[model samples]
Target: MAKIPGVRPPDLSELTRAQDRMTFLYLERCVIHRESNAITATDERGTIHIPAASLGALLLGPGTNVSHAAMTLLAESGSTAVWVGERGVRYYAHGRSLARSSRLLQAQAELVTNRSSRLRVAREMYAMRFPGEDTSGLTMQQLRGREGARVRRTYREQAALHGVAWDKRRYDPDDFSSGDPINQALSAATTSMYGVVHAVVVALGCSPGLGFVHTGHVRSFVFDVADLYKAEYAIPCAFEIAAAGYADVAAETRRAMRDRFRDGRILERCSRDIHHLLLPADEPEADDLGPDVVRLWDGGSRTVAGGTSWDGEVDW
Candidate 1:
């Protein structure tokens, strides 16, 4: 069989960096099943293994019960979990584990605040449009075109906030990746990252049925967090892998994605973005995750004075 592209990797340990300075991610990568504790997964190949426990974030949503075996796994890991569209990148301390109450609270507050802020920006984009006196009975075609116009205007305005050129066609067709084996993998992986993030988020309880910015239709929340983290995590990692050049692009894209799993920044990003969960420890040994986990002064390491307590107001 042709080697399938797009390998998804999971960060084994939590790495939280200085708040706001590092890439923050909300973890979304897993197969969520209903009341099933036993996990059976096959790699790109048909080879299958029955895992002793559930994989990734195991969320037993409302009116659901996790199998005993799954519960045991949850108890042992004390892992934070997502509840199939109920949480929507939200994290809940594993019931079996002694969840760091204080840490989770602060993280959740900050992350929720951050998510809210971004969504607010998207909403503002809609509100700021030319809501002037026009033809009231405009057909769906007219309104659809208007919304597209609004989206472009919003993207440009948002891009300007970062001093970047705002254009709809960020990737040009002329500069397309090489048709060789190496570039193909990178391209596929890059294209797939959004879908992957969306899958995980939906499994973790982001209600596509209810959306703030995206329309609440056809699995809406899948790419929600991906929109927030892909640029920081997947984009750079894929660059490093593709630059090395390989025989097969699709296969390699999968490998590069797996490699990205080990990045500390990805973990930091996930913990930072999802609200209702205390942000993880960005700086090792620090109890509170303060703003600016890591910074550069003249491209040099800079540290802020404080302990591991994310106290007071947060402004990223």
Candidate 2:
């Protein structure tokens, strides 16, 4: 009898970078199975093949059944799998990270744990939102007020530009249809942004729970990163879609955001922004932030080689 050979997983270096891959691919009401390096989704209509390496995040929506082999391919390619609710309206959970090293995670932890450094990082985040404005001396309260004004101004401007009715943002997570078209659109767009940003955060080896501005929550860092582009990308897209008065606002919003993300190179910008926020400006950039290597703690910012027998050398 002939023995069946196992499928070989792609090397980390061989996989596509998160920034260069598709923003996301949403699959629903289909059976997902593996076909070599690609994943095939089959339903009554037909089957579509997607290169696992080219996907940044795979949104497994309602009725989507993915096989173990398909999941293995996704994990190996560093593609994040997000299990979401119907129409991708609600987020349930997410898969593992691609990071093999703890360098960025350590940096993030060091910065977030220190009060002064945490404030500095938070200011840097607001500075990004304000662009030319200097937030160096502003207190957290002042920063919050300033950000509130900016967001209000953005909402008003976008509403005016799109000729849509202006109203304060309001949405009910339990009932998607409860909100006005604009609010619904905003929710959908924001959710999509979070999905994409979460993927990049995990891929970079940073702890999503350790955030500079938004603390406590497990996805605090994801929120921090996603907010960086909310004004530039999500808000405008949402307003435009609301003005168009699409029958299926959520679906249309997702499609519009997907195109917007692609054209805007959002993935690339997101990756760069995250690195800038977590890493010092003087630190040199490397192709691989987290290499597939293990090390032993040598104390005080030092590490020794892993897999070594130090039992005899060290005093017991």
Candidate 3:
């Protein structure tokens, strides 16, 4: 039998940073295969090669067939591959996280498990939304109330500014088209936001299930992070798109969201904000992109070197 060589995966530092990559690229009705370091999408039109590391998320819509080699390259490049339904309204699955280190995940777990620390983190999240205002003394209920009012005001203001019909938000996950134009726009916009934020959350070695303000769901932390930029990006973009009276609200919303993400450098901001939330100000920064090292848990305060026998030193 002849021997075949496997493709060498790039070093973490050699790949493009998640924050610097394209927001997302959607493809349907195509066959995706690997060629060297890039993925090629072939269809009736032709074939297009995309550098795996340059992509933040690769959305595979309906009628898409992906080769295993292509997927492996995407994973190694830290580019998230999301399997979604038409217009990206339904999320089916996602690829592996880019994180090699568990440092941020440990910090998230510790903060979420303790009630005081959890509340403090929640307050910090709200504080980001309400700049120039102190939310340190406010209770959870108070924070929710304030946020609700602020969001409502934002919706009303945007509706009025865009000359669109103002109504309460209404969405049915099972039926995306049931809502009005504005509601549909909002849903589509937020869904896109979730996709991008999910990539960042996982790439940073953070657990999407461990959230500060939100709890329980697998993507609670994703929601927590997405909400931070809704007002600044998604909400306004949705309103603007809805007002334009586009026939395809969902499609237009996706394009608008992509532009906003790129123009505003939302990925960079998202990564920075997540780091700020998880890491303490005084704690020395660790190399998130450094080599993967496994350590055995000793206690909350420390960890011992892994892959070594400690039984001889400790007598049973």
Candidate 4:
């Protein structure tokens, strides 16, 4: 079950198929089931069919239940199903990977496994956050300090601009009510960012635990990537949502953050950033290093002139 059973490998033609352009979707109050080629959700009201292929990731929030068949279909369609807590504020578990290739993942592992290369990639990530800045010589500690200072400054600036009282970020995962409005909103915003970043990370065939900066957790890479966007998107959105004085700040913040992610094309940006970080600029292209394949497409048949067709089974 480690690999999707009986699913055909994805090809170039499959990539252009019409599907949901929306990268992430949060849904609740439904029971998901597989119906033929589509996944449908049913509730007390009625049934709503979901085009699983269109989605990058499906956020199963509170009150949602999914069948094993639905999960299978989702995996086959190259969509990830993420189970989350209320308002999609917490990540509980993930279903399956939608990645079609191991090329990028292998590259990420090579970079992460080497101490020197890991440090270089970490610095590269920081440099992207603060464009035009020279972070080449900064140690990990110094990078953390600078990043902390930048985040604090951003919080202060956002609070001042939004006229919201920001004491500090305080939150308890077990007790959400313990945190103030701003902190709660910040948590919600960051969680949303993490979910989206996770989707992109998986889609790009990278291990979530193989983070350049953040470490320890299984989703270390997800945290590392999400932090890149917090200052510009999540932090500001949280402050602004708090300032607006909405009764349901968490929900409103998530809704607004979702809109921001869509407008910012965060998924595409994250994919590009991860690639630039993991793949060295001077590294040769994958095709250049791999076996050459002279492919010929005639009508509906695919012919690899000198190679055998890949069977459905993969080593994983």
Model 2 segments beyond 4 Å from truth?
A: 1-5, 289-291
lDDT of 4 by residue, 1-316 (tens): 4876664533434442212246677889899997766789899999988777667788899888888888877876667788998878888887665554566887888988899999988998899788889999999999999999999999999999999997788899987767889998999899888888888777666899988898888999998988888899999999999898888888899899989988887776787777777777786433111222455444474544435555543565
Can you write out model 2's per-residue Cα lDDT over 1-316, one digit (the tens) per residue? 8766778878776787878989988889999999999999999999999999888999999999999999999998888999998778899988878777676888899899999999999999999998788999999999999989999999999999999998799999999899999999999999999999999888877888998889899999999999889998899999999999899998999999999999999989988888787788998755553566788888877889998888888786
Candidate 1: stretches off by over 4 Å = 1-54, 57-183, 209-211, 265-268, 276-316
- For each candidate in the order shown, give its overall lDDT on alpha carbons: 0.38, 0.90, 0.90, 0.79
Top candidate when judged by lDDT against the true structure: 3
TM-score of each: 0.36, 0.96, 0.95, 0.83
lDDT of each residue in 1-316, candidate 1, tens digit only: 9876532222223322222111111222333222333333322344233332223333333344444444444433333233432212122233322122243333323443476543543443233334463534444356557766654565454445434332333333344343433234335455445434432333233333233345545443434445454444554544454455555544455555645644444433443444322223364323232322442233345544444555554776
Runs in model 4 deviating more than 4 A are 1-12, 15-20, 282-316
- Model 1 alpha-carbon miss at residue 266, Å: 3.8
Better of 1 and 4 by TM-score: 4
Higher-TM-score candidate of 1 and 2? 2
Task: Report the error of model 1 at residue 135, Å.
Answer: 31
Model 4 lDDT at residue 169: 83
Show how many residue pairs clash in every candidate, following the order shown.
Answer: 32, 0, 0, 2
Write out the backbone clash pairs for model 2.
none
The full ranking of all candidates by lDDT, starting with the best, is 3, 2, 4, 1
Root-mean-square deviation of every model: 17.2, 2.0, 1.9, 7.4
